[model samples]
Target: MELAIVGLGRMGGNMVKRLLRDGHRVVAYNRSPEPVREAEAAGAIGAYSLEEVVERLSSPRVVWLMVPAGEPTEQMVERFAALLGSGDILIDGGNSYWKDSVRRAEWLRERGIQFL
Candidate 1:
């Protein structure tokens, strides 16, 4: 599957690498340019912005977030929700509280975006 991963920290970056190894198309983005450049060198497409990430993916886009918990994750989800269309999926791989995750899932679901 084609996926866009935001926040190229250790976990996220490794996810991109593993996905590439499995022959999946990955678009990687980071707040810092270095991680993104590194991911690009490792065969992942580099996206500088959330809009670019969305633009790079095909329909029924899948975007994974690896940002920090609480405010950071919330902000990223909100930003991606605005960019992604109905039928798109957002996966959060951070250490967010379960309640927050539930809330986010419901919110995204209401907007026609799947959350996991």
Candidate 2:
């Protein structure tokens, strides 16, 4: 499947590599340009910004967000909701509180985006 991974930390970075090795097309983004370039070098498509990440993939886009829980996750989900269209999937792979996850899912649903 075509995937967009947001966050270039250990989990996200390793996931991109594993997915690419398994023949999936991956569009990877990170706060730092260095890791983006590194993922590009590792055969993953690197996106400099969230907009770029969305543009690189076809809908319905599947984005895996591996950021920390709480504020960062909320902020990224908000940003992604704005960037992604209806039917796009946002997978928050962080260890977020269940209530917050439920809230985030509801928020995304109101915007026509799907969260997991």
Candidate 3:
């Protein structure tokens, strides 16, 4: 499957590497350019921002967030919600409370975006 992974910290970067190793197409992005470049060297398509990430994917894009929880995750969700159309998927791999996750899931679901 093709997907974009935002936030190329330790977990996120490893995820991209593993996915690439498994023959999955991965688009990787980070706040800093270094990790994105590193992931690109590892066979990921490096994207610097959410806009670029969205542009690189085909329809029904899937974006995974491996950043820290709270504001960063929330901001990413909101940004993607604004830019993505129906049928896109967002996977949150951060440490978040169940209640917040539930709230976010419903909010995205209402907009026809799947949350995981």
Candidate 4:
């Protein structure tokens, strides 16, 4: 599947590498840009922003977010919700509380996006 990965920290970076090795088309984004470039060097596409990442893929896009919880996750999800349309999937792989996840999922659903 086509994948867009936001927040290229250790987990996100390694996931990009593994996905590429497994023959998946991966578009990687990072706040710092360095890791995005690194992932690009490793055969993944580099996306500087969420919009760019979404634009680079087809419908029913799957984006994995690997940022910290609280403000960062909230901000990212809000921004991403604007960029994503119906049927798109957003995966938060952070250490967020279950309640936050439930809330986020409902929020995304209200905006016609899917959360996992």
Task: Give the least accurate 10-residue stretch of model 4, judged by summed lDDT.
Answer: 49-58
- In model 2, what are the clashing residue pairs, if there are any? none
lDDT of model 3, residue 115: 94
Over 4 Å off, model 3: none
Writing each residue's lDDT as its tens digit, candidate 2 over 12-34 gives 99999999999999999999899
RMSD of 2: 0.6
Which 10 residues in a row give candidate 3 its minimum summed lDDT? Answer: 76-85
Give per-residue CA lDDT, model 3, range 14-104, as digits (tens): 9999999999999999999999999999999989888999999998999999989999889999999998889999999999888999999
- The TM-score values for the models, in the order shown, are 0.97, 0.98, 0.97, 0.97
RMSD of each: 0.7, 0.6, 0.7, 0.8
> Which residue pairs show backbone clashes in model 1?
none
Give the total clashing residue pairs for model 1: 0
What shift in Å separates residue 12 of candidate 2 from its native position after superposition? 0.7
Best to worst by lDDT, what's the order? 1, 2, 3, 4
- The Cα error of candidate 1 at residue 41, in Å, is 0.6
Cα lDDT of model 4 overall?
A: 0.91
Candidate 1 lDDT score relative to the true structure: 0.94
lDDT (Cα, tens digit) per residue for candidate 4, span 1-116: 79898988888889999999999999999988889889989999989877899999888899899999988998999999999999999999898899999999999999889999
Off by over 4 Å in 4: none
